[model samples]
Target: MLAFAAGFIVRPFGSLVFGRLGDMSGRKHTFLITIVLMGLPTFIVGLLPSYATIGMAAPIALIALRLLQGLAVGGEYGGAVTYVAEYSTPSNRGFNTSWIQTTGTGGLLLSLFVILGVRTLTGEEQFASWGWRIPFLFSIALLGVSMWIRLKLKESPEFEKMKVQGTRSKSPLRDTFGNRRNAMTVLLSLLGCTAGLGVVAYTSQFYVQFFLLQTLKVDGRIANEVLAIALVLGLPFYVFFGWLSDRIGRKPVILTGCLLAAVTYFPIYKSIAHYANPQLEHAHTMAPVTVYAPPGECSLQFNPVGTASFTRSCDSAKAALARNAVPYSTVAQPPGTVASIHIGEQVISAVDGKGLSRSQFAAQTAAFDAQVAHALASSGYPATAVPADVNRPMLVLLITILIVYLTMVYSPAAAWLVELFPPQIRYTATSLPYNIGNGWFGGFLPATAFAMVAATGDIYYGLWYPVVVASCTFVIGLVFLPETRFAAAAKISSARASTN
Candidate 1:
């Protein structure tokens, strides 16, 4: 936890530093540096020793590595967005900027796939102890690949034009924040776009996992697997939505998504509820069977019961019987029932047939088992031999809705943010607000939401945090955010006309 907090704390500073460097020097250079920095720490995290080996020092090292990661990420997004936006024509800005957005989803999906592959190969027990570390260590190779791509990327035309014109800001920070107008623009832009993007993005991904584990009581492995599948399925939508914004305009696309999210939030949650609950309306229509034991001591036994034993004492018989999924009519047993069942310390009593023949009772038990199986299959619960609760499927469905909203809003934001400022201060100006909104607001989502739930004692209340924030940003976007689809194109056309 300390590591996570420390990393977040350093992110804004990293953004400030890298943003300035990108604006002053070049976006491509800044991007390569941040990628290398981010990847190396991730690799080191995989190699770190556990508490048992190094005691308190282990956690300390982990925290330091997290801080490094935070710093690197803080700068990475801003540079990548600016680099892409600068090269793109204004008419296709949304579509081009979306490539940067898509990278984030791609990165997450890649991580999920790696984790899933490792788990499948190593199995659960071995994976927990050491197999989990392989993915993080493997990122060193990814970093090298990114570095190669970044090296090949050209400098932005806008920045080049600014340099030739001798119009680059002497002090980018002063120009960015020293002027009240620019500062207000930055703030309004973030409030209008990035804030909501941050919430939606985190809610869709991180909060879903928490909801599955804590609220819906889903098996962690199953929940993760479902989420991984959903994310991969939805990956194309990120770029598709980004392209749509180019045709329809950024504000409309974003506003439509936000409005749809607002209208559908409750309904989506309800759908999940219906799907997850076996007793709910859409649950599999299975006939229920009731099993009853006769008015005597009854023992429940499993087939292929290895080394199974029951005790002579009444309490022991009840305790042993309760562990099995036997449906008995009453809680109490008849007198002398306990003493009659002890055979070599293993109890064997006359299995009851409550108002039914032996064969009829057996049929009822089979029906109950079939119902349980149907419920488990419909719920997508883990296929363990033991019966488990079926609530996570609903939570997973809710997460899918959230992811849709997230991708819709976030995919276009890179273009919107990049277009808001001139090339001279674009890197620095965009990075500061983007990191704070995403790294600070979005990244802290799980921690903040969990803390709120812990304090309030209601899981649903934490959702209000994202809902309220997103709504406010949606309103701001409707009122304040401009359509930037044509801004760069207009500028280029004007430049060409002047030259002609």
Candidate 2:
């Protein structure tokens, strides 16, 4: 958990540092630096030892790499998008920068494909132990290729023009912040534009990937296959929407996507649950379970690292059931009393203790976990989702629709954001809000939603996070966000031209 949080926690700081560099220096130079920075750490992450092998040092090393990756990515997007947007005339800004958006989706698909291919070659059993590193190691070649491509690129014409005209920002930070208008626009961009898009984009991709593996217990192979197919099918829509925005408007397309995600998330996820894990859905209704404990005794079900043991019965019982994806309501029992799990008509008593040795505790917890797993399996709950029973075509369709929502919010985002700020402070002004939205708001979706699901024992409850965020963005964007394609850039250009 701390490691994951570390990845996001450093992004805003990275944006601050690299955004300054991008704005002051050439966009090509700064992003060239960022790409190298990002690629090296990613390559090293593949080589890092696991926790079991190196203890605390392993996680620490991984955390450091993640932070580095965060920093690189934080600065990388702004420069990349700004470079593309500046190269594009107003007529093609949305369409051209939409290709940048495709890289994100395409990169994810590429990585997934490479992983599956590697796993297939290495065989499934060996892949987990040693083969996982191949993809990360392969990033070195990609890094070399990326460096080559970046080397050939020229500084953006717009930025170059501004520099030659003696209109470059002396201090991008001060210029962006000293003025109330830019600050207010940046703030609104966060609340309305990036925040909503972040939630929608991440929830569709990362959260759905998580739901398939962890919640549905679907085989990783099938999930990846399905996702890759959906991505390929839905991938063109990113460019289509971006091109569409040029004709219609950025706000309408983006906001419509947000509203669509907000309204349909519940049913979409519910359908996914039904088609992907039909047995779990049926068993949940047929043999429901409830856990009883003292009101405040149950610990929150969020321990990403396995070091902490939720030894208390209230915590242990819920953890066991939650791991197996068994939905259970918590019942309040007498304070300080031992916990109990009521499965349909059967009641299972939990072992209680005020103090116990570590060995004794582990043994007790292991036994308790086994007991709960047995009870759930016996009550017709699946141990892991069976692939043969799934409605594969329907699952693909649902995930494809989710990807469509992703494209709606993400496709035109770069062009829209680029249009929000001027050539002088564009990199710094836009990067902060964009990174904050994705890094902080979107990055934690899986952990946050999983916690919500664990706490409530309702898998669908987690959808509320994205749904609420997207809905808020819809309303906020409608009111505060400006139409950036035609008027926004002119306004920013005039404002900056006057100031500089």
Candidate 3:
């Protein structure tokens, strides 16, 4: 929570500094620097020691890293978008700028893959303890690669043309905000475009995670896996829809995403809720079971007085018990496996996976009926259980639609925003609005939406926040946003001609 909040707090400042620098110097250089900065901090985070070892310093270091990350990211988007937009032809500005937006989805997908690969390799316990850091550490390699690519790219043609003509604004901030017309244009552009993009981005990506885990009670692992898959599947649509906007016009694509989101939010949430119910029921019915014995054998040890005994090989299970906040023993077993199982606890059970008939299994189990019954009851599995009715496909479909809406709204803004101001103040002007909308509205979405559900006892109410915000944005776009698909170069050209 603290890390996420830090990202929001620091983003606007990053935008200001980087945005100004990008406008003053060159977009390529500024973007490359921000990318390197972002990657290095994330890499450092992967290497940092845990709280158990570092004590109070762990959280402090974590916060510091997150702050750096926020700053780096705040600058990165504006720089990248400006670079793309300045280089792109006005006719294809939306399509070209959309690549900047696609990179964000790519980053998310990359993070997801790293997390999943590490988890799959290490298993849950190990992943929690040490494996979680690998992905962050891996960012060093990614940064190096990204830097290489960025270095090879040229400065934007538009900014170069302005520089050649000596037409760049001396004071970008003053010119941008000092003029009422430009200031209002910036305000209206943010209200119309980025605001909606921010909400859709968070609602689709972040909120879906919350809705699945908190509201529907889906397992975190499953929810993340599902989301990762959906994100990958939906990624191409970001560029595709962006390109479509170039042909059809930006307003239609963005408004379409907003309208679709508004219409689908409730149904998507309901579908997730409905699917997750059965999974939760199944989890309750067929609870997990663990068994413990001596190091090499399944032999049980009894105390001399037959009241308590010590077991040495059960260290793993004991560790598991400790992790779950359950109390257990390295020393003591009450007669059977029944006492071994506890609520919110794990018990080690010895079972052969070899094939056996149902009746044969039942008859065989009768031999240890008391112990088996105790284990079953303790593990929370009833003798008679109903089958679960989980609709995984339906859930996947809904999440896909949600990601599509997010990408549609977000992908076009990168170019659209950069075009709103002159090259000189483009960074500062665009960055402020982008960060506020993305940082405050987008960042707080999950928490705020959850709070709404908590207060109202209805999950769908939270959807209203994004829906209403995007709806207003749709209206704003229709009223205030100009067709900037061909304006950036034109502005520079006009400035140059005036000077000449």
TM-score of each: 0.75, 0.94, 0.75
What clash pairs does model 1 have?
none
- Model 3 C-alpha lDDT per residue in residues 1-500, reported as the tens digit of each score: 67658877899889877877877787888888888778888899988887888898998898888888888888887877777777776568887877778777787878778788899999999999899988878778888999899889999887898889987777666777789988898788778887788888999988888766655556666777778878888988888887987776677788778778877888877677657555433434366433433334222221112233222224323322322322122334443332233333643343321365656545544443444455545664433221244456776778888999988888777767777677777777888788888987788777666445433324467789898988888888887787665555576588789999
Report the lDDT tens digits of candidate 1 across residue range 39-157: 99899999999999999999888878888888888898888888787777767778888777877768777877888899999999999999999998888888888888878888878
TM-score of 1: 0.75
lDDT of 2 at 51: 88
RMSD of each: 13.5, 2.7, 14.2
Candidate 2 lDDT score relative to the true structure: 0.87
- In angstroms, the error of model 3 at 314 is 43
In order of lDDT, best first, we have: 2, 3, 1
Colliding pairs, model 3? 290-347, 290-348, 290-349, 291-347, 291-348, 291-349
* Alpha-carbon deviation at 107 in model 2, angstroms: 1.4
- 339 Cα displacement, candidate 2 (Å): 2.1
Candidate 2: segments with Cα more than 4 A from true spot: 49-55, 302-311, 351-354, 488-500
Query: Each model's C-alpha lDDT?
Result: 0.67, 0.87, 0.70
Q: State which candidate has the highest lDDT.
A: 2
lDDT of 1: 0.67
